[model samples]
Target: MNLASISTKQYVEQRDKGYWIAGTRISLDSVVYSFLNGESPEGIVQNFPLLSLEQVYGVITFYLANQELVDAYLKEDEAEFRRLQEACREKNPLLYQKLKAAQAQKNSAA
Candidate 1:
C-alpha cells in the first residue's frame, strides 16, 4: 500500500483544529484526558461509543510513544481555550456577571 494510505490507517489524524481519531469527531485530547484520569481503553470506548476498542488502544499506544509532544500540544490547546473563554466573557460581561452571581447564589443555597 502507499505511504499516505498506510498513514491514514492509523488511529489518529491531524485535523485543522486538532487531532482526532479516524472516522469520528472524538478528539485525541478527550481520549488522552480520560486515559490520564485513570480510564481504561475499554472505558474510553464506553464513554465514546463512536470509537472502537482497537482505535482506543491504538491512540493510547500513540500517546505513550509521543508523550512529551502530545502533552505540549495539549497545553497549547488548553491555553487557546482559556483565551477564547476570556474573550467571550469580555464580550459579554453582563451575562457572565449574572451567571456568576446565580451560580454563587445556588452554591450558597446548597
Candidate 2:
C-alpha cells in the first residue's frame, strides 16, 4: 500500500488487488513454491516465458511480504481439493477401495 516502502519500484496490481512479482505468467504461489524449492528467479522466468525479470522479483517481494496469508490460501486450496477428491471417493467407496487396494498390491509387487 505504501509506494515508498515498495522496493520493486514497479509492479502490476494483481487480481486480488495485491501486487505480485512483476513479470510472472502465473500466481506468486507457484513462484514462491519454486523459489522455496531452490529455483532461481531467472529459472522461473525462463520456464514461464511470458514472465519477465521484474515480475519474478515483484512476486518474490510480494511473497516475502505476505507469505503467511499466501501459505494459508495454498493450504486452504489443498484442503478443498482433497475434500473434493474425498467426496468423489465416498460416492463410490467400493470402486475406490478396489482401485486403492490394486495400487497397493502393484506397489508392493514392484
Point to the candidate with the largest TM-score: 1
Instruction: List, residue by residue over 5-36, the lDDT tens digit for candidate 2.
Output: 87746554466533345543366567778889
* Residue runs of model 2 more than 4 Å from their true location after superposition: 1-25, 92-110
TM-score for all models, in order of appearance = 0.84, 0.63
User: Which runs in model 1 stand beyond 4 Å of their true positions?
Assistant: 1-8
Q: What is candidate 1's lDDT per residue for 1-110, written digit by digit as tens?
A: 67666544588889996899877888999999999999999999999998999999999999999999899999999999999989989999999999999999999999
Note the Cα lDDT for every prediction shown.
0.92, 0.76
**Where is the poorest 10-residue window by lDDT in model 2?**
16-25
For each candidate, C-alpha RMSD in Å?
A: 3.8, 5.4
Candidate 2 has which clashing residue pairs, if any?
A: 21-55, 21-58, 21-59, 22-55, 23-55
